[model samples]
Target: MLSDTGYPGAVGSDTYDLIDRQLVHALQLAPRAAFSRLAAVLGVSDQTVARRYGRLRGAGAVRVLGLTDPERLGEARWQLRVRCAPDSAGAVAAALARREDTVWVSLNSGGTEISCTTRTPPERADHSLLLQHLPRTPSVLSVAAHCVLHTFFGGAQSLVAKSGALSAEQVAALAPDGPETAGSDSPVPELDATDRRLLGVLAVDGRAPLAELAAACGKSESTVRRRLEELTSSGALYFDLDVDWRIFGLRSHTCLWLNVVPSELAAAGEALAAHPEVAYACATTGPSNLHAVVITRGARELYTYLTTRVAALSGVQHVETAPTIRTVKGPGPLPLPSPRDI
Candidate 1:
């Protein structure tokens, strides 16, 4: 079985050394920064930075992914909660994981509940899997779809950046060049064919070399570089690092479904967003208007957080905690497990 660290039975492999943590934090700030740039910022040799990243990637502990902001693309993002027959939960989750539109698929609630996030383009909203296939599945007992209204945290934000592995100066030094001031009112740039092709390659590997991206998108390197800058600057595309939290000594992962007074929803969400334990938090349309993913050291720590920090939040009427049993997919594409592993 894969251990909590997402490594296959590697004892003590989850603990990242100081350099490793620093490197991760650096990448969290600038995911596509050249190795030489990262090394210089981290005060290490370029070879060392590259070697450490290679090791982390080979161990399945980290991945850099370039993802489009669904809101910028005028797409609807949904958080799906599916309750299934106990025996079919794993299979159902596996199916969801294989879908390109779905991410963060996990088994929860004693292997009978599945939670996932899916993006649906406006053109396909009526025909989405949430609207059609899941409701019709015999094994699915119920499906609750929550439309994400606003994100208080997550997306380009990384927990690694909050680790304090790098100093303020280091973070500033590695920051991408540009004035990123895109707001809700910023004009959404329409993506063309080349832009789509470029994003397709980056979706798999955010750090893919410029030459490779140019070839895949059928554009010159200079054009590809300029287009990438435009997309990022416009807040249409952002890079994220998918890493196992256990590497940071966080061994427990849970989803928090909270019902808060509508008047205080924004306040509560902003508060939760500030907590280090929260990996993702957003406002959604549902009985539980606020949802968050939290990471902690273990079950005991999770309990403490709920009893202390979470309990201290104002206007929370109800809270439901669903600890993840296993992740079927994360932010990046994940290989399906073998039948034996499943």
Candidate 2:
């Protein structure tokens, strides 16, 4: 089900027969969109949507994840591009996929190359380790990684149209079954400039203190608190975990880009995500169709992990690796109004 790198996918592989292309389609529209609402648009029952969504999450086909704004949040993110010996490259790619902090990995262009991503405290990890740690391995030939100053979703959901086209059942699915809803209307939160700024701050720094943020933004402590509450209540914000892979002792880092058979796409994706090293895997619209990020303690440990672990997975035809250089931001921030206007 896999092919050599740079082998044009147009040549046809069984990878396109995906199970829940709908899930990916939904995510591209609203990453955190409620499953109930999605059921309506997809013409499926609410519970079915929920169950399938759970399956998609389990399979790694649809990542309904959120990104924190790194800029205002006082953190940085980065990417690593690894070039390893062609023969040992798949082993290296598998090795890097195991880390918790690896955002994604991919083998692209050909088997000689790979790429890995991570989010970390800005400028903290030894840049040399980020670059040198993996390539130093016996199987590795060369490596390159760059700390990302900024990262943004390429808007994959827009690939699917009709965002608000939920079915009637789907609309009811969004309703909370509470006595208050019997007679009273559920409150919908409103956002203003301060609300937006407060969200922007948290988007970048989840740990930013309310008092400090208020002071920095020139608003009252209570006002900031209320704004935060309102925005979160409105579902305008979501939380996620962020860690530095190295400090977390997940030292071996690499990106894996895999080409799977069309018939095997769903199974291959599910298998990859189920692996502990396959921290984040996604079927994007691209070359190394399947991408993942993995982490390990060091080179020796990573080598064993790849060959003995990842190389054994079925439907995995080819793999490549790119050792990371460094991470400037993890998942930190999104755009905010100028002058820190909240």
Candidate 3:
């Protein structure tokens, strides 16, 4: 049965039950697992698992999506901070949310700044959003682009995995076969037209049925399944969940910019990645060499985290916190605007 709690906006008052959390964690381990398989691991009826997921998805509490890894494709990933006029931040964020390349579009710094991540292919470097579009926008006051150097966590790694709702045995049982990436010496795999079509379908729904994927990709079920495995094993594709953290009693979301000693940069990033509060952490080229997105229960928890956990780290000189005012986009693609809206 569904909970009696209301579907709160981004930060809500109600929390999901243990079963719900366990189910989410299970999915994080095996996103494309069959309903029967998930039920077996979760010790719940298949119908119950499906119903709970449906309810959560209907309430906009969770979403499952398939995403490409920019590194595997030899593309450039950027973290952008766009400072806009006070009155223009909302419009600027909405415009950015409409972009296919932009993800995690957020209004931060009291809604006067927009933070987002964008992926650029090699061919589009000359005409990318950072180099061309944002600079020409009249309402944009300034733009800071940080080239992502290395990700310590948060591509296929999900916070739910750290929730401890699932047992170690269950996690091992659901772990997918094959490594996520090839060695550096291995040649990068290219995505053909068929692979692109398959990925397009999965970008919307990672758990789409085999028959549905086969039809959409104009291939047989066997072929589609094989290709899916190939992409995942090659580290060219991954499944991610966009979950409303409020459902877990986490109400505060903030981005942290930190400058660490060059010698300890890698250690600092790895340490941040292990923190359950950190949703994403990476090393980037900028004045602030380390970047992380953290979520906490509320203002008090965020303060405590900064004072204790973050302050305890070594070689950390400074920290800048940009509280997210609103999030307009997540991990998935958004519907493109029509000519009239544009």
Candidate 4:
């Protein structure tokens, strides 16, 4: 157990892994689940859960926060395809990724496009505001901004499920037809090589035209469309509307990692994540028990936020903020190579 001094050495890595997977799974199952319920179901003491969770936060493995809907909150989302000069893509991407409004950023096709997601604040985040930062960045050849109409991936869930611990019977008992399988937080559908390839493409560009994706995957657009529909329906994939965060007057981004009193974690987590500033929240294995990515507009705004704001919530024992200097690779499709791909 971390001493009051915060040694963080009492909980070992093995213990953290077991609970971390379980925590994410539980979250996958129910985003707003209280820690007490999760601990009871997972068969661990609440204090242990809290201790280990603190460790996970220290490890930067997970975060718990509210997934705000920008459109509902009166903001717009955009995808920027930035083209930079040779060897300059990395630098340009680094600069662009640092802004609080830049939620997601990545380089693809050997850096031809530095893809990113940004929220347009109601007053300051117009298309030109986006370009305004790039000209000063150097080596920014061109920038293409696509207004996001739909999302196929990357929305934060209130909870996650761990399919490893729960049996098919248990899943059926809890939520038989909800959305996921007993042992898989990932929605299930049989995907062929082409389907996997298509996912890879979408991971980079959810807006990839069906014709383009089909050509890359060597399939027809109709076949691609039908397959995509099946994948989404089966819950293997989800759409992302990609709303912008800035317009809603959300001006700051802070990562809040807390070690809640596990006995009260269940109720506390739900209440804490549901708070307004929390934009992406998750419960994971802990040393940093809970990780919450918060948003606000400026320094003064954030100062008012934590001091006059979130500090009032109950069950919060510890909170730390890491001003995000950059998001190297923002959350999107986390597709990975199967064992064979190795």
Best by TM-score: 1
Candidate 3, 1-342: lDDT as tens digits: 111111123224355788888888888888888889999999999999999888776666777889898888888889999999999998998899888888889889888999999988887786369988999998999999999999998888887787788899998889867665665556656888888888998887888899999998899999998888778777889899878765567778899999999999999999999998999999999999999999888899999999988998888999999998877788887533324334
TM-score each candidate: 0.94, 0.41, 0.92, 0.44
lDDT of 2 by residue, 1-342 (tens): 121211111122223222245444444444445666666667678887777655543332223333433333344445566677778766776566554345445564456766656555545655444656675777776765554432222111121222233444543554334321111132435546665566556545444666867976689988776765544444444444333232123445566667766667666676766665555555543345566665666768768867977787677788866554333223332122223232
Q: On lDDT, who's better, 1 or 3?
A: 1
Q: Model 1: what TM-score? A: 0.94
lDDT string, candidate 1, 1-342, tens digits = 675534333236345788888888888888888899999988889999999998786666777889888878888899999999999998899889888899999988788999999998888868469878899988999999999999999988777877888999998898767665377778767898999899988887899999999999888999999998889878899899888775677778899999999999999999999999999999999999999999888899999999998999999999999998887788867643435455
* Model 1 residue 102 lDDT score: 93
Model 4 alpha-carbon miss at residue 27, Å = 26
Runs in model 3 deviating more than 4 A are 1-15, 178-186, 335-342
lDDT of each: 0.85, 0.50, 0.84, 0.54
Clashing pairs in 1: none
lDDT of 4 by residue, 1-342 (tens): 221111122233334354566655554454334566667767788886677555554433443332333443345677665777868877777666556566566555445556677777566655554667775567888776656543321263421331244555434434424443122343456556887688767654454677888998998888888876666545556433222222133334555556667675566566656565655544544354555556666678777777865676566788766554334545443223224334
Would you list the rank order by TM-score, best first? 1, 3, 4, 2
In model 4, the runs with Cα more than 4 Å from the true position are 1-187, 241-244, 247-249, 333-342
**Candidate with the larger lDDT of 3 and 4:** 3
